[model samples]
Target: MIQLTVNGKPRKADVDPDTPLLWALRDSLLLTGTKYSCGSGLCGACTVHVDGQPVRSCITPVSAVAGKKVTTIEAVDGSRVGKAVQEAWRKLDVVQCGYCQSGQIMSAVGLLSKNRRPSDADIDAAMAGNLCRCATYVRIRAAIHEAAKALA
Candidate 1:
């Protein structure tokens, strides 16, 4: 059994140690907000916060995060920074297709949690791995800036 804290809840997944965390989350834990795209971690669709840092769940082994805290989009609004990011995303209409928004928001929250004031270059670098096929980069950047301001 692999044990971990998920969204503030203690949970256990009875899976192989090498099983990807995405499957453990989506299949065992039933938290599907962390998406699966480009399963090799090239894309950030599977982004989730492990120990307060963003990680790609699709390529991460469940055992790798053992005994650590894993936060997903489902519980994002529970935090001050997360709430601000979500609000900014809503106010700015950052969702285009909506498939990748959860991961995008996860990455944004991760970025804002550490750096309260991120410039365009910082935002780009932080969000470089996350891909939005719909190309909503403008709104995403705007929402990040707005969230930073809100959290200030």
Candidate 2:
């Protein structure tokens, strides 16, 4: 059994040590907010927080997450930055097809946590991994700025 903390709770999964964390989260833990796209880390759809730092779950082994905290979008509301980002996302309607929004939101949370006021360049640099097929980039940028202002 691989032991890990997910969404602030202790979780134990009887699975292969080499199994990817994405499967552990979605299949065992049932935290499905983290999407699976590209599966090769090219897309940020599998983004999740490993001890508050954004990491791609699809490529990370479940054993690597053992004894560490894994924060998914389901639990992002636990932090002030996360709350602000989520509120901004909701208020601005930043979701397009919604398939990528969870990853986008995770990436945004990672960005805003380090920089309270991120410029467009900073946002772009941080969000370069996440892609929205609906091309919601404009609203996303605006929402991130709005969230930064709200955080301030």
Candidate 3:
């Protein structure tokens, strides 16, 4: 049994230690907001916060997260930074196809949580791994800045 805290709730899953956290979250825990794109962890679609640090769930083993806190897109709005980022996304209409927005939001929330005011280069470096096929990079960057301003 793998034990962890997800979205501030303690949970246990009866899965193999080698099972990827993405499967544990989607299949076992029913947290499907974390998308599965590029299962090899190259793409940031499977991004989630493990102890407040953004991590690609696709490559993370469930066992590795034992006794740690995991935060998903579903619970992002619970926090001030996350709510600000999400509001910025909605106000700016950042979603194109919508498939990648969850991951993008997750990455953006992670970036803003650490750096209250991130420069363009900081946003680029932080979000570099998250690919948006719709090419919404400009809007994403703008939304990040907006969220930062809102937080300040």
lDDT of 2: 0.93
- Worst 10-residue lDDT window, candidate 3: 98-107
Which ranges in model 1 have alpha carbons more than 4 Å from their true place? none
Compose the digit string of candidate 1's lDDT tens values, residues 26-56.
Answer: 9999998889989999878999999999999
Candidate 3: give the clashing pairs: none
What's the TM for model 3? 0.98
What is candidate 3's lDDT per residue for 81-100, written digit by digit as tens? 99999999999999999888
lDDT of 2 by residue, 34-144 (tens): 999989887899999999899999999999989999999999989999999999999999887899889999999999999998999999998998988899999999999
By descending TM-score, how would the candidates be arranged?
A: 3, 1, 2
Looking at model 1, residue 126 earns an lDDT score of 96
Could you tell me the TM-score of candidate 1? 0.98
Question: How do all the candidates rank in terms of lDDT, highest first?
Answer: 3, 1, 2
Q: What lDDT score is found at residue 41 in candidate 1? A: 91
Q: Is candidate 2 or candidate 3 better by lDDT?
A: 3
Query: What lDDT score goes with residue 7 in model 1?
Result: 99
Model 3 residue 49 distance off true place after TM-score fit, in angstroms? 0.2
RMSD value for candidate 1:
0.6
Residue 31 error for model 1, in Å?
Answer: 0.4
